[model samples]
Target: MEPVMPKDPEVHSAPAAVEMSEAAAANEEDPAHPETMAFCPTGWLPHGHRCFKLVSSDRWGSVEENCAALDGDLAGAETMDDYNDLHTLAQFFGHTYYWIGGFYFQGVWRWIDGSRFIYNNWHSQNSASSYPCIALRGAGGWVNTNCGYSYPAICVKRAC
Candidate 1:
């Protein structure tokens, strides 16, 4: 399958074109409705059933904090489609270490949202470390890193 890339880095949406058109019109009518803002907010990118946003580099804690303030959490991908969407967004901005939701806590990898820790694309090296958080590596993989180090982040939440 061809990789999906956003024509504009500032926005993206799921492939449901007709539904999106209807939603857009409804959004015009009732801008405050949660349904209207469910898929993708004004500046966020949408894929499948979630919306994503890439924030500027900051310490891991701060990044996650910002996402929480916006009602999101650090991004996590359990499927290839999810990974592809996030990877494409990262490519658009040329970011290498965007913080994701996975973290090493209590001897296992877990998502910040408490979702089951399932798929992973860790780089083949010293990736299995005691670092508290994981960051997406350049291109399309992951690396363990210090949570205190400043790095960009990918925030994600359900699409309503």
Candidate 2:
């Protein structure tokens, strides 16, 4: 199924309901620590306290499973910085759309890593039941689409 795009492509503002955590805010303000780079494997980008990498395209479930095999899960964006970093990384790797860790479950959207799903930049709020998986658009904004669709994905693990 084709992902739905917002009427105004430039409307990519995140909802103001969520506040960035103190730790995340601090990390965003500070540059990556030198030691953090050593923790990330070659090809993985080190940011804040985590390492992120873009994986090959596949169905959401398969992509998630592939991430798990690498000792991580699909990436989650707890802050606007985190979201933008993920988007930038995917774009850098030339992927127009890629899966993240967001999913609608039991009426609530949750990150696969169990982080709170507070921050969002949805292009349009589609019915969660029909489009349960979340993918990030390289141009900007998020899209809700079927989990079965194949797309590249970002995987994140702690840099420690």
Candidate 3:
């Protein structure tokens, strides 16, 4: 079945625009802090001091590896804002189903990046052992599915 679009107000209300710093606009890299990025990289969306991107379809594991290569991990929704932002990003990109950082591990749900799994937007309480990975439905809410299933994925990393 096709997922439904979210009715959440926050999802509809556009997120605040993030402006690039002067250094970032100049494309200057800081020699003293090579790790610091003034802005998100090309093709990435900047929001609240973080950068996010959607990658092409792949299995959950493969998608995570792809995120790692970009110096990030599968995206996680630790708060309502995070969830709304991710949902909006997917909707904007015209994706129906996309992988997030959630997974069933050690008999508990956890974000791949080791973030606390406190907040959630679960579509249902059904979490069968066979469905170990979490995917965000562009329509709304999160779903547990087989890890081997292929889907586009959202990757996120801190923006310095």
Candidate 4:
């Protein structure tokens, strides 16, 4: 959806019209949460606040359907503590795989809330295969992994 801003012929015109979309609007967001705010390190749909990806090639599953499977979909996580809540959510609800707004794909790790990947809660000997991205091994909690891996990814968005 394109939001029309007030414009003038000289100072601003239709030519100056900016498309508030992913590529155009990207980098315009604040340097807060790195997860949802950052680029889709993994193939997922960015609903601005939430990033979502299909579990498999299953077209039967819609964004709402994926959201329905998650305990915290549109709620919007504010802090690491809030992300902690997703642990339980991903446990029982996820089927094949789900995306989370936490990764370090760009060398510098960050969360959807803009928090740096300072403290990782990865379980056991699991390590980050790729830089700047992480994933959850089903009910095994979170793991720092490469975004290149074939994992079902999810994103976080604000609740309207």
Alpha-carbon TM-score of each model against the true structure: 0.70, 0.75, 0.74, 0.41
Say what the RMSD of model 3 is. Answer: 8.0
Residues 1-160, candidate 2: write the lDDT tens digits.
5445333222223221123345433343333555334245555566656877767777899989989998888998878988888877766656567789999988889899666588888866677888899888887888888887767788998875
Please give me the total number of clashing residue pairs in predicted model 4: 20
TM-score of 3: 0.74
Candidate 2 clash pair list: none
For model 3, state the Cα shift of residue 108 in Å. Answer: 0.5
- Tens digits of per-residue lDDT, candidate 4, 91-142, equal 5334333445565535555665566756555553234332334455445455
Model 4 misplaced stretches (Cα beyond 4 Å): 1-80, 105-107, 112-114, 124-131
* Model 3 misplaced stretches (Cα beyond 4 Å): 1-38
Clashing pairs in 1: none
lDDT of 3 by residue, 11-107 (tens): 2223323334565445455757655444677656665567877776778999899999989989999999889989887877665678899998888
State the displacement of the C-alpha of residue 80, model 4, in Å, after optimal TM-score superposition. Answer: 5.1
Model 4 score (lDDT) = 0.41
Worst 10 residues of 2 by lDDT: 9-18
Model 1 alpha-carbon drift over 4 Å, by segment = 1-38, 125-129
TM-score, predicted candidate 2 vs. hidden true structure:
0.75
Better of 2 and 3 by lDDT: 3
Better of 2 and 4 by lDDT: 2
At residue 21, give the lDDT of candidate 1.
42
lDDT of each: 0.66, 0.72, 0.75, 0.41
Q: Which rank order by lDDT, best down to worst? A: 3, 2, 1, 4
lDDT by residue for model 1 (3-33), tens: 2221222222212112234544233324454
